[model samples]
Target: MSHIRLLVPLLITAGILIGGNGLQGTFISLRASQEGFSTSLIGLVGAGYNVGFAIGCIYVSRMLRAIGHIRTFSAMAAIAAASSLAMLLVIEPTFWFFMRLLAGLCFACLFATVESWLNASVTNANRARTLSLYRLVDLGSVTAAQYLIPGVGIGGFQLFAIISMALTLSLVPISLADRSSPAAPEAIRFNVRKLWNISPLATVGCIVVGLTNASFRSLGPIYGQEIGLSVTEIASFMSAGIIGGVVLQYPLGLYSDKLDRRVIILVATLGATLAALYLAIFAGGDEWRNLAGIFVFGAFAMPLYSLCSAHANDHAGDGEHALVSAGMLFFWSIGAIIGPLFASVMLDLFGPGALFTYTAVVMVAFMGYTGLRMSARPGVPTAARHGRFRSLLRTSAFFNKLAGDGKNGDQR
Candidate 1:
């Protein structure tokens, strides 16, 4: 097959995955609302997804090691499809929680498969560009999905079915394509205590990032409701935050790469704190103003995890990168699980605005801690480059070889 032909299937697969994932952000809360779920129940639904995602991350690599990428990817997609369709028949909060959990598990598998594929396929010269393209597809698809809510309506279970179909459809290209499987990491068990010992700042950064992100994802809709925004408006508002994250990541990442990563993290934490404070205190009842605050908040807050991931990788040895990534994932998941419950209680007690208030307080503490850490133990100078995107492109061959190796032998 021509290389150009190969690109078509890969890009299509990316589109399907991105679009399918994007739908949940806009639809999940609204769907729960239509079924008369309470705020706490809705929070549980969101938490279920993250908990499942964390579980998937822990085990899916082993599954891939056992079955290879294509089979595992296909099976996961099928499971996700079944789970999505099942939601139509089961409307209870408990049932929906299980469904969301299943969906999250499938999502983690699909994401792992696709990201590994992308990582393996690109040559060093285009690694960054390919990753950037993948991210762009994700952001664009998510933005488009936000606009899809009004047409589908909150009552339509068919939307979930449609998302399931998209996930299922994602397997077709990979199943038939000529690309090799990507190399999965060896089963290096991640220990949170060990990770903290390696880079305490990075460890803390992941936890904070996870807490902020999960809270925002799960409760943003409820907050929107309390503030009296319409469903469509809420979709737009959430989309704005996502868009902010997508648009700002490159520049911010580049800027961070130029100096001490801890310094960059500290600045981002402080900036996010200010943004959250602005939203919590001055947002008032103006919908547009509130949306703007969300955008700013996302611009600073959402990228923290990625920055932390990169920083952790920076301090880790080559063999430890995957372990560090896994550790970060673990901490992030823990944060995700705890964030919604805490944020929800705060909202219930102090009002919806307390969500942002909680975020701001967390950010302030994170910033303060980062400053103290940096002052206490300044580490070796990081790569003085502008962005990882360029480096990624140059290493595409490494990824391609890694993918080819995974096809022929067990990564684990």
Candidate 2:
């Protein structure tokens, strides 16, 4: 009860923040397509956003170090709100690209601020609960926000105004709340060589999941529009993956906790490969099958990062989980930065269906890598496991930083 009272403002802040971000992501893809932006150009815009987001993840840590959380959050939130409205001011692809880049930078900072606040407040005992509640806010808001697309009307300025309003009003909670904020987090470190030594499989796995997930997120709506779905249905199409991530995260997490996570990773990659194949070739014209395929693909793909984190922690030296988590996100961001362009070119050459082809190919490569790694090294002993498999939001570096902070234990 005390915890709820203390964190309610921050939780509300996070929910509203993610809601606006969710709306903007789908809104841009839908609107860009409607404006006749080339599929490649739209993908570039999305890639530009990821580029800004990646920079923000590293930059926000330093910015917070210099300025503290409240000022950073307030300023970033304001910038994000203004950036949302800026999209409405100009309709060109280049302009939208710049707007999304700015939004990404702002969201990256907001997430870091919110997460650092949560981490500083929760004890090791309550870390899981705090993180779970945070995840609930994240998944719920992002999923529901997608439904705003049809009602707001993709062609009009209404959705942009609404997103900006949400961002602006969200600031009120933080400003009015009387609770104390968390201390600033120390600078997070990332050493690629050390990360690879800890768990090469995790390093490879993060990149693959990033590539597959980023491509779908940035370009999935255009795929839906190409296949003749209305804007509302496209919203559902995007939401289905989030639903899959929510429903499947824990059960698979429980299973992975008890087994060689490499085995679990292999199983997940194979599952994603099959699902992507189904999406690419067999799910034609049937919304149910396409949605089901995406849901299953998400179910399999979303948890691998968590699984990889758990796997890496099992092999990491004591007190290195934070460092490794930061490194893993860096690897993931690299994949994300490159993924949209790669997928967009595929879409350009092969059509909307090729999006799944991109995923399928990557999952196959991932499966091969995991298979080789499993053959080369024995599994981390379950008894010796040093970390739990917690479902992480892939949106920002904040969660990755949090994942490293608490005592490691089996989550399920």
Candidate 3:
């Protein structure tokens, strides 16, 4: 019961952070259109955020080590809050690109601080449950943010103000808390070859998930607009995917543990591919139908990351969990950096439907690759594996730290 008390502040902090984080992608994509930016150009603006986020992960470890958690969190929160408002001050895609980049940068550091604080706060006994609650808080807040968008009306400054407000509110909880400082976060080492050797499929899966997920989140609003959906409908469409993820992630994960993990990966990628194709071909003019299809997309697409991550960790030695998890994220960032730009180009050259078309193609390619890998190697006999599935949250740098001192395990 007392542990719950400790977590409440951090959970509230997480919710507020995710709320702002959720709204930023959709708000910026929608607003860019209002400012008359081209589809490809808007995509670049969105892509800039991922690039900045990667930089934050890559570079901010040293800064966090120097400055400490509370100060870093507060600093990033202020910068993020200011960045939200700064969007209201300008209309250029290039300016907005930098602003989104700034938001991403702040969030990366902010996520690192939140995650480190959470890891530090927990004793080994309650770490698993606490982390579980944190993941639920994350998904719920992000899902809520989608619905919250309609209330603010995306065409004007109101939405930006709301994003700024959420980020501001996030600052209060952590700043006022009486928690002790955590030890400095570990310096992450990114070795690409080591990751590929651990599990080629996992490394590749992270990158492809990055490509598909980021494109959908960053450019999804534009796709919604391109189709016949209203702002309210667009919110619903985005939320549907998140809802699907929350519902299906655990059930499917439990079932996956019973079989070769690659089998589950194959099935998930196939479902994702089909969902993307459905959205591309059949989802026009009908919001509910679109919602249903997107729900399936989320169910399959979102869990693929966790599945792949779990698969990789199953084969890794205990000490290497952190390195493997962090490296997987490193690849994910590479894919995310490139995903929006690529998806956006498809939108420009083909149509808005090209958004999903691109995702579907990628899924198909991944599916074939996974099939090849499965044939070549035997599944780790279920008894030999030590790690379990952990849902990966893009909100934090805690991927390596999530499982708690390497006892419970790491990310999705």
lDDT of 1 by residue, 1-412 (tens): 2433556677678778777776875588777866788777787888888788888878877887898878888898899889888888878989988998888888877777776666556554554455556656667877887777766777766688788778878888877877677776456476767788768888888888778878897888778878888878888888988877755677777877676877778877887888888888998657999889989888888778877766765665535555766677777877887787788778878888898999998888888888898888865464532124211110112222222223321111
Over the stretch 113-181, how does candidate 2's per-residue lDDT look in tens digits?
A: 888787777776666677778888888899999998987789888888999999998888888999676
Per-residue lDDT value at 236 in model 2: 91
- The runs of at least 3 residues in candidate 2 whose Cα sits more than 4 Å from the true structure, single-residue gaps closed, are 400-412
Q: lDDT-based ranking, best first? A: 3, 2, 1
TM of each candidate vs. truth:
0.89, 0.95, 0.95
- Please tell me which predicted candidate would have the highest lDDT against the true structure: 3
Which has the better TM-score: candidate 1, or candidate 2?
Answer: 2
CA lDDT, every prediction? 0.73, 0.83, 0.83
> Considering summed lDDT, which 10 consecutive residues are worst modelled in model 1?
389-398
Quote model 1's TM-score: 0.89
Evaluation by lDDT, superior candidate among 1 and 2: 2
Stronger candidate by TM-score (1 vs 3): 3
